[model samples]
Target: MERIAVSALRKTFTLKPGQTVTVDGVTSDRIAVLDGVDLTIDSGEFITVVGPSGSGKSVLLDVIAGLTEATSGVARIDGIEVSKPQTRTAYVFQQYALFPWRTALQNVEYALEVRGVATAERRDKARHFLHLFGLKGFEDRFPSQLSGGMQQRVAIARALSTDPQVLLMDEPFAALDAQTRDILQSELLRIWEQIKTTVVFVTHSIDEAIYLADRVVVMTARPASIKEIVAIDLPRPRDLDIRNSAAFNAYRGRVWESLRDEVGKAQRDWALASSYAN
Candidate 1:
């Protein structure tokens, strides 16, 4: 079954002086952020998007999440066109975006609370996910008290607490240090393995994309489109040792080569944008 269907998505942002089409003339921006991106994601698929900064990777994800509108295109979840945010999708952002006043458990329960889950049931479900994320003891801790990775874990648990059919993550691991990022990545994989949610993940790190995705969708620069959908062909429950394997390097090299020109173009575009702003 198709979990996400995107066709001919083009998005433009109107600036004060001009319009910047972040995604232009692209068909299928919904296939997990690829260049020339016409792709379909099957239900329960774990797909990662790897591109240089400003390659419209996040824009693609936002379109799928319905956070941003596509200027011209179609994004559907479960065969229904998504014109706005749907309850079936949940997004975990890089910044952990938790309520500062809420404790970890309370934060996790926030979504359920909003959905009007009964107090007892919501607390129970929230506690379960918190425990699932290894956040059992930290339930009482505020975001200020937790480390960066822990906060992200809480964010993930919170997103999952809503029982979303599809998970959209925008570089959730980027803010953490190397060791913490590795640990959370491993933990996230474990959670995904158990949950079987269709995941569309965005990241700039080749290693992370290679490690986590069944397929890596590499994208081009501005007005970005899918360049290639590199199947990892690597076995699941991926371990750090895989990063050293020849297969890992092979995939990483392919992504870099595919994105080489796009990276340059994106950098130049940024410089141009800065110049225009000034």
Candidate 2:
């Protein structure tokens, strides 16, 4: 079954003096940054969206998460049109977005608190998730007390605590060091394998996309549209070794080759905008 269905999705923002549609029109914008985009995802599928910065990768994730309202078009989760934020869908942002003052367990419990889950029950559930992330001993640690990767683990635990059916992540690993990011990527895959939730992940890293997703959705520069959707049929339980494989490099090359033009366009746009700002 389709977990997400987007149709004629369009989003526009008018700068104070200029009215512009950042995304014009397309069939699916599930990973399209511009207006009028359309796309669909089946249940339990892991899909990664990759493109140069400003290609609207993050915007597309936001649209699916209902964080950004589309000027026109439809984004539906489980066949219901998404008009507002729904708990069935969860978003894990790049910043980790955790409370520095809260302990890791408390951070995960926050969502349950808002949902009014009883104290005892929420604590039990939060503990389960924290332990699943190898954070059992650090449940009492605050965000400031943990490393970058640990903090992101807590963030993931908190997002999963709600038992969301669809997970929308925006560059959740971009802030970590290379080794840390690699570790978390494996952990994320383990969790996904167990939970089998539908995931829409956004990133600019080619290797990351190749490492994690079952399919990679490549997008164009601003007014972003789906340039191509390439399948990564690599065998799972994938690890660092997969990165050195011929199959991995072959797929990586295809994704990069398809994105080369869009990356150039984004760079040109940045240059022009920088000149105008000065």
The numbered model that scores best in TM-score is: 2
> Which sections of candidate 2 miss by over 4 Å?
17-33
Clashing pairs in 1: 8-28, 34-225, 34-226, 35-225, 35-226, 35-227, 36-225, 36-226, 37-226
lDDT of prediction 2: 0.87
Global lDDT of each candidate: 0.86, 0.87
Q: After superposition, how far is residue 143 of candidate 1 from its true place, in Å?
A: 0.7
TM-score of 2: 0.93
**How would you encode candidate 2's per-residue C-alpha lDDT over 1-278 as one tens digit per residue?**
89999888776654544423222343232333485667889999999999889877787778788888887888999889887888888889899999988999999999899999999999999999999999989999889999989999999999999999999999999999999999999999999999999999998799999899999999888777788999999997787889999999999999999999999998987886677567
Error of 2 at 183 (Å): 0.4
**What C-alpha lDDT, on a 0 to 100 scale, does residue 63 get in candidate 2?**
79
Models 1 onward score TM values of 0.91, 0.93
| Candidate 1 global lDDT | 0.86
Clashes of each: 9, 14
Where does the lowest 10-residue lDDT sum fall in candidate 1?
27-36
